[model samples]
Target chain A: MRASIVQTSVAVVATLLLFYPVLQIVLLSLNKLPYFRLGGEFIPTLESFQWVLQQPEFWRGLLNSLVVSLTTVGILLALSLPGAYAFSRYKFKGKDALLSFYVVFTQVSGGLGIAGLIALFAIVSALGLRNNLFALALIYAAGAIPYHTWLLKTYIDTIPKSAEEAALIDGAGVNTLMLRVVLPLMAPALAVSSILSFIGAWGELILANLFLSGENRTLILWIYSLMSNVYSVQWNRFAAAALLYSIPPVVLYVVLQRFLKRGLAFVY
Target chain B: MRPQWLILPGLLLFLFFNIWPIIYSIYISFTNANIKNFPPPPPWAPEELKQARPPPDFVGFANYASILTGPASSGFLGAVFWTLIFVALSVPAKVALGTFVGLLMSSDRVVGKPIMRALLIVPWALPLIISVVAWRYVFDPTYGVVNQLLYAVGISKPPDWFVNKDYAYAAMVVIEAWLAYPFIMTVVMGALANVPRAAYEAAYIDGAGRWAVFTRITLPLIKRPLIYASVMTAAASLQFFLVAFLWNFIQLYDRFMLAYGYYWAFGSPFREYGLAAAVLTMSALLISVFMILAIRLAGLMRGMYES
Candidate 1:
């Protein structure tokens, strides 16, 4: 009984630790006292929230986030769907090597390529494309290719090829068969990839910070820039903005938790 | 059956954007590329930064030589050391904690397990940018929750969390683990649900204790998923920046990891394109060498994951 109590206490503590940061942010958003005033009395108000709503940056960031994320997902799916389909069904030379390339390439961690790309984008920005969300989306799509391709290819492999071959023998063209028959069967995989890709693009900051400027900032950049000058940061307003900024990603993850589990299982 | 030529567009983009950058990084290592005297004239202005910034003068191996004998060499070494330590510490901690939480949630013994599990994934579900930023604030010196709670107790002077190098580094590790362990936990819980109940019943019948049953029966069954989680987490921790950099700016130079080094090398106002490319080229070379060795050692090339 004592051991069980100890275990329960430990579990409860761990769970509380997970929720603490979120709680603080929520409280900070609604509180009258600035900086959350840890021991101060709670006086809930919507003033901070109103302040966030009044700022054009919040709406701009929202619009930019949606555009960037959607364009990224669109471009990613366009590339990954076909690339994965071929890798799955085709008997090409160096197919295994190619698959290995994607797998290994994905493991190369942060910003090695981004370093080079920054210089490229600097020049591109000089050519009057600074703060362009499409250009940002294009960079995001290119970066997402290696892993998304691998994921989609693995997913495509699970699907039996008999249906595809049957469709082929019925004199259906390749594109038609892909679009009509195999596509519907691969809905779960497509859904999983799209959600994950959207989440990635939505939260991306490093590139957006460097590539974008002025009013073209994403939600993350806004939060970061607010925090950049730490001394003058209006804590209540920042917290309100932070909480509002987190809505889409939180919603996406919650609504599609099932797909994420299914999708991530294959990633391992 | 003929899904051919469909890969062309992706391949081209990958080549143009991704592969080209990597190759360009290597090529620029041999040239003079810095933004000190940039956009020289009409030909240079509005031209590709690579051609205009870099003098188009081939300075063979000079960039590499400078780094080897540079003031930043020690900083480079320190970054490498800390990167290894960060990876070494965080990966195992994430795996172990994730497994423990997974076991707790999966077991029928724990009450209110549903709420516990939901709360556990809150960090993972939220935007990482916000979560990381929140963690940074929580570790703040005076007005932060952590210090406030510390003062509310007995200790009046709670050491500034992000000031000391050791404290800041430890906080970064903890925050990152908090952010990431959910991935492993969720996966393990799912994997655990698939574990055959019959195996446990048989183990219990054989007079195996709880520990024996877990270590012997449960562990081996879930080993593959655990290994995958470990490798993924390990790779992530190696390049961890968002948490480590956000926690404190002052101590960053003392422990600048490879990712930050790369960021500073080229991303700064007066970009050192040639030297930055050299850094990236060397970093890539080292990584590929390590990866090839890891693959060969594990025999991962020939369908180790096929089953």
Candidate 2:
């Protein structure tokens, strides 16, 4: 009983510490004032939400973000499905070498950092691809390939190859075998990869900041811009926009939570 | 009919977008590619301006020299030192705190586990920008709850978080730890589930204490996942950028390697892309060396190849 009390106390404290910032932002978004203060006015209003909802740029940025994120999911699945299929099923030359390279490089890819940004900036501008949303999606998709391919490949390795062998023996081509036999069996893994890719592309800012401009700005960029001026920041409105912007990813993440450990275990 | 051909599409995209950029970045690191000459404006630009800012010249090792032994060396070196310190301080904090919470939550003694878990996972699930912005408010110094609580406790004039360097650094560490612990905790919880219940029963039957059981039995079982998380988290710490950049880029840019490289590229008036590339190249090399050492030490790659 004593241990239970101590455990409960610790759990409560930890949960509060983790939830405090999120709670503050939620309250700030509903506060009447444009800025936040600990003991200031307590009048509640939806003015910030109204203001944010009324902006044309808000809608445009939302559309742009959706387009980029969905396109990323599409391209990512297109690339990773085949790539992981090849990896899981074949014993091609350099198979182990390539897989090792993927795992090692992805681990330290953060090291490469934004070193490539300069060249990317140069190349995009020179090719008239600046401010192009699709081009931006291509970049996000490309960066995710190494990790997601490995993730799905690990997942594919779990399934028995008997069904695929039967399909192959029945005269089904590779495409039919994959789409009919493998893809359905791997729906959970596909959902995990797709949602992860969507969230990544959705919240991404650095490359988007460089490659995009007015009207092509993503939802994250628009919310970030709200806080840019700093001196005249509308904390309430920014909070509202941020909360609304965060909804899709948060929902998708929660839905994906059950599958997260299994997917992550393979990668991390 | 070849199965290998299936890899072509991803390989092509990866090469064009990923491999090509690194190669291009390396090539430009050896050239003087700055705002004046690197990215020529769209074709609609003025003819004279285009002619004025000609193509980048091959500066050879000048950019590398400036970063290594030239006037800019101090900033680069300082950023590297602070990044290492940040990683050292935060990774352990995140892991230890996460492991503690994971053990607590996994205990049968803890009630309302479902609700607690749903609440705890919010930090990890929400988009990062929201959390960072929210943290900005919490540590606002003047109107924030942190200072308010400090004042209530009879302390006066807590240091402004973003204004003071040390305080800002501390705040960054706190936020990074908070953001990352959820991931570590989840990983720990997963690992814990795999631990045999019989081992714990045996330990208790033999008159083992809580600490003894944890130190001897639990630690060994969970050590592999913990090591993996630490190394990955450490790599992430080395690449810290967005939070610092968002919090106070001007003051904190010199405190992180990537942010420092960012300053050279976009923050500086000269737009020294070549210098920025060199800085990033060195950072990449450093990170790779660190990762290889950690992986070899931890035997992390053994599991990957086997799986």
Candidate 3:
């Protein structure tokens, strides 16, 4: 009984510590005080949200984030579906090697290696593609491909080949079989990949910073700029922006929580 | 075989965007390429221009030599040393805390497991940059929550977290640990669920205490996931850009001409691409070595794959 009480207390404390910062941010966003104090006594107000909404950059950044995220998910699906199918079905020479390579490469750091990426971008730009949203999307998609492919490949392998063999016997072409037969069965995996890709593109800062400069900053960059605009930290505005920034991901988690958990169980 | 062709576009894209750039950057590191030498000097330039130029010359080992012996050499070594310090301090704390919390949550006796798990995921699920920014605010010296709390508790003088080099790295480590533990916790909770209950029961029957059962059964069983988590954490730490960048912005404010330039000069900025590459390559090499060692040590990789 004593041990149980201690365990319960520890769990409660851990939970409180975990939620404290988030609660602080929410409170700070609502507080009307110019400065945020640890235990500030102030009536809540909507001014922070008002200020965040009034910013033209906020709306534009949000729009850009949505576009980039959607594009990235689309490209990821397009590339990974076929690629994953090939890996799952085919027994080509060097198949295991290729799969292992992607698995290892998936562990590479994303944004920390920006210098190399920038050098590559410089080369790509010289080839006539200027730095823009599309280029950024392509880079994001490429970054996600190896991981998504590995993920989808594992999920797709769980799907039996008998289904595809049956579809082929019905005079279905390979593409049609993939589209009509395999895709529907892989819906849960697809949903998981889509959400993962969206969240990745949504919150990605480093690549967005390096690649999307000058009139193409993503939403996170815009929020970062807002935070560091001047000497005085705009606590209210930053909180409002954070709350708004968190909405899409929060909604994503809530809506797909079940499927996402199931998919993660498969991967991890 | 035709289906294999589907991988062509992805393979080519990976080669171009991922593999090719990595190789090219490795090559560029050996040369004296900087921002100015980017376009490469005009085909024909004056002798003085040539003399004054810090061209992309094949001065083999010069850049590495400069990093080792330059005036900024200490800072470079310090950054690497600090990175290791941060990783050493943060990773184990994260793993231990995560494992403990995960075990608590995974246990059937724990109350509010769902809520605890959700709360744990919050830190990890938040956009890392946003969370770092939030943490920066929390650690703000004046009027910030952390300092305010500390001052209230009678510790009147709170250290300047971001400015004081002595504490800055420590602060960074704490925040990094905070951001990272949830991830480790979630993965660990999953791994712990797979821990065979029978083994623990057998340990108990053999008069093993909780510690012995954990050490003999749980720890050994979860070793592979633990190794994977540690390697991933180490790799992620090697790319510690955002904390340094954001800390510079928040702490330094408008004092510096270039927030990024300072990072390049001292932190892992683009100008020192070679050094950064070397650092990253070394990190990757170390991670690979650890991974192989982990496989050998655990003796489970073959079993896991073969099964």
Query: What is the clash count for each candidate, in the order shown?
Result: 0, 0, 0
Span of 10 residues, lowest total lDDT, candidate 2 chain B: B298-307
DockQ of candidate 2 relative to the true structure: 0.63
Q: Score residue A134 of candidate 3 by CA lDDT.
A: 74
Better-scoring candidate (TM-score), 1 or 3:
1
Q: Write the per-residue lDDT of candidate 2 for residues A40-126, one digit (tens) a residue.
A: 776799998998899998999999999999999999999988989889988888888888878887876655637677777887787
lDDT of each: 0.74, 0.85, 0.70
- Which is the leading candidate under TM-score? 2
Once superposed on the true structure, which residue ranges of model 3 sit more than 4 Å away at CA? A1-3, A230-233, B39-55, B69-72, B194-217, B249-262, B265-307
lDDT of 1: 0.74
The TM-scores of all predictions, comma-separated, are: 0.90, 0.95, 0.88
lDDT of 2 by residue, B118-222 (tens): 988888888888888899899987768898899899888787998898899999999999889987887788778766778888888999998998889878867
TM-score for chain A, prediction 2: 0.93
Minimum summed lDDT over a 10-residue window in model 3 chain A is located at A109-118
Clashing pairs in 2: none
| Candidate 1 ranges beyond 4 A from true positions | A1-6, A37-39, A109-111, A122-128, A260-264, B1-4, B37-56, B266-270, B299-307
Decide which is better by DockQ, 2 or 3.
2
lDDT of prediction 2: 0.85
